[model samples]
Target: MGTPEVSRSPTKSPLTVSTSLTETVDGFHEFKIRSYSLTKGLGVGKFVASETFNVGDYTWAIYFYPDGKSPEDNSSYVSLFIALASEGADVRALFELTLVDQSGNGKHKVHSHFGRALESGPYTLKYRGSMW
Candidate 1:
């Protein structure tokens, strides 16, 4: 036997393709909250929510759940998220969160959308109540 016969599915349709674009900003909002540890006493259930801030053209707030966001975690880990606090839907943007080290080492850890290539434009908020 030299070569094997290849079978193809004729019923399979061509895949549809979609693409999106994200706008980049020259500067960041740089909202810093000091004494973050003090907020831990607030306890779960919206432990601490940042004041409404604007990023791009939409308003947003940072929510920190020191005791985990869902009940499944049982407060083992801290959960941080960004919430859309403005009107409109399908809003898209890039974001980054940084946790500063109190040691003054200047080696803060950062997580951001720019770490990976965006295949679907900016992050879509979907609705006014979306979170990321």
Candidate 2:
């Protein structure tokens, strides 16, 4: 009969780890809607999208729902959204939507992540995600 021998190795004092860095790359695109009256007839839940633009290596677009995105609204109000138009997952981004003033009064209405007083991390948009 024969017996087997066993050996053990000592643990290393320092463990090695690796990490990656990402510097934010910024880009912008502006879309304007002309003939607002013509869009209202497009119907509820229907939207017109802007041309795709690239930022941080991803494609994005703006969607305008002239008759509101929800069918339940009965076309009471208009809606707008920013969407990730390309194939991607867990994409992080910030968004700004503004309604420009046609009049000379300079009273444009703005909805923006940039205007917030508190510091915030970018939003995580999953594959084919849209933000209102």
TM-scores of all candidate predictions against the true structure: 0.66, 0.73
Q: What is the lDDT of residue 79 in candidate 2?
A: 82
* Pairs in clash, predicted candidate 2: none
Query: lDDT (CA) for every model shown?
Result: 0.71, 0.79
lDDT of 2 by residue, 1-132 (tens): 779777879878898899999778778788888887899879999998899988887888888998999988789878878888778556877677887766659887777753652257677788875564
Prediction 2 TM-score vs. true = 0.73
The window of 10 residues in a row where model 1 has the poorest summed lDDT is: 24-33
Model 1 score (lDDT)? 0.71
Q: Once model 1 is optimally superposed onto the true structure by TM-score, how far is the C-alpha of residue 132 displaced, in angstroms?
A: 0.5
Writing each residue's lDDT as its tens digit, candidate 1 over 1-132 gives 689888977887789999898566543555566787776645555557778877667788887787777878676767777788888656767677776777788988776753645554568887876887
Instruction: Report the number of the highest-TM-score candidate.
Output: 2
Candidate 1 deviant stretches above 4 angstroms: 1-27, 113-121
